[model samples]
Target: MTHVSTRPLEQSEFDIWQQAIARQFADAQVAAGLWTEEEALDRAVEANRTLLPDGLDTRHMILLRGVLADGTPIGRLWIGLTHPRGVAGCAYLYDIEVDPGFRGRGLGRALLAAAEATARDHGATHLELNVFGDNPTAIGLYSTAGFEVVTQQMRKRLS
Candidate 1:
């Protein structure tokens, strides 16, 4: 694995990151059957905006961009305290992704490590995240990273 590092997301990169994250999240929701194609984008945008009310300056939010030793962007991570003032000692991983072109290079695991460190620095004793049931790769990654399933939701579609 290459030496992957994380840095604060630059202001100039926010728009591109926001757009891509929203689109990817929307697609995932649609794939999981939790959203419709027509409304997914709107919902995604609103949900993100709601969580990131101050964008990069949002309280308790930690947004970082992962890069290789050469400074090439490979991925991004978003994490935050689950409660105000760190009362819960828990952090929620809102998002993490490796660029399609950069996948399978172990960057994802590096980003996860970065997230854990950042969350810990912010007073989080535990970290949690929600992955869609359809994302087996993410599930496997988290599982192998020592994450366990706390609960699950199941659905059966009928036509």
Candidate 2:
């Protein structure tokens, strides 16, 4: 197994990473029947538009690219600081996606460990992430990483 390095994303890497994330979310939407292909595409387009502009500020909302020993990009992780009350120094684990070809090789675990270390270095006592109930793999990963659900949020879309 090769070691992975986390580095802030460059402006040139935004399009590639955005497309990758859009594809992943599209697949998830299709699998969950949450949207049709057209809907997924529209949503993806909007999402890309929203995120691509923020690539310039790689400090507060940092985007980290995970690279293999030989410098091949294998995954992406986003860590953001929280501003919610009573949650000082809290960090949000935004998006974590490992390339399909690199799944089940402990890359996800390594990426998460890196995120936790970053949070700790930033003076955070706790990290939080929102995982869909259907995403058992993510839930398992978070559980193994010592994160437990402090509360459950239920929502109903009225649209």
Candidate 3:
């Protein structure tokens, strides 16, 4: 396994990350009964648009690609700083995905470490994210990476 490197997301990689993020959200929404597949897809697309990185603000949002020794992109991690007040900042772990072929290779952990480093560099005091209850694998990964569940969003169908 090669060391994962972090870099600012390029325009060319935006669509790929966007699609991956949309898929993640869509899956979660469907599992949570918040939306049907079609509805979830639509909402994910919109959310992707809203979260697209902007360069104007000093708010740093980075997308990191984890590459194999030969440089094949096996995973991706991203972070967005929501607030930066003095030396303390708040950030969201926007996306973290390991390609199907790359699972079980510890690349996910590597990507997370990179994200944490990025957060520290940006003066972030805490990093946060929402994980679906169904995604135990992700929950475990996040837990191991030093995230605690501050709150859980529960839903009941009114229909």
Candidate 4:
């Protein structure tokens, strides 16, 4: 497995990271049938703004950038150290991404491990994430990483 070093996101990287996250999230929502193509980006932008009001310094939020040993950037990870009700020892993974060119090299799994370690360092005993059903690759990665399904939702179109 390739080794990836993690570091706090730099100020200069914020715009690119935010744009990538917004676009990817909007695309995911559209693919999951949860949002219309025309509205997905706008909705994603608003949601991100609300979730990250303090940007890179959002309370209880961890935003990390992954790079290779030689300092080549690979991806990013976003995690919330606390749940909505102030649940103890719980962390929520909001997002993880590897540059398309870097996929399939175990970087995703590496990022997951990093995320877990980071959460644990912050006193998290459990980590949770939501992966859209359309993303089977992520589902498989999370499953292989010992994550079990806590809940699932199903829907059908009558059209």
Q: Relative to the true structure, how large is the alpha-carbon lDDT of every model? A: 0.88, 0.77, 0.74, 0.91
Error of 1 at 101 (Å): 1.9
> On a 0 to 100 scale, what is the lDDT of residue 112 in model 2?
84
User: Candidate 1, overall lDDT?
Assistant: 0.88
- Which stretches in model 4 have alpha-carbon errors above 4 Å? 84-87
Worst 10 residues of 4 by lDDT: 81-90
Ranking by TM-score: 4, 1, 3, 2
lDDT of 2 by residue, 54-147 (tens): 4647445668889887888888888776633447778887788788899999999888888888778777788888787779999999998899
Q: After superposing candidate 2 on the true structure, give the runs of residues whose Cα lies further than 4 Å from its correct spot.
A: 26-53, 83-86, 154-159
Please give the lDDT score for candidate 3: 0.74
Q: Is candidate 3 or candidate 4 better by lDDT?
A: 4
Between prediction 1 and prediction 4, the one with superior TM-score is 4
Query: On TM-score, who's better, 1 or 2?
Result: 1
> Each model's TM-score, in the order given?
0.92, 0.75, 0.81, 0.94
lDDT of candidate 4 vs native?
0.91
Question: What is the Å distance of residue 81 in model 2 from its true position?
Answer: 1.7
Per-residue CA lDDT of model 1 for 1-159, tens digit only, reads: 566789999877877889988998999999988899999999999999998999999887888899988999998888887743444788989889888999997889988988888889888899988999888899999999999997799999899
Clashes of 2: 0
Model 1 lDDT, residue 96, Cα: 91
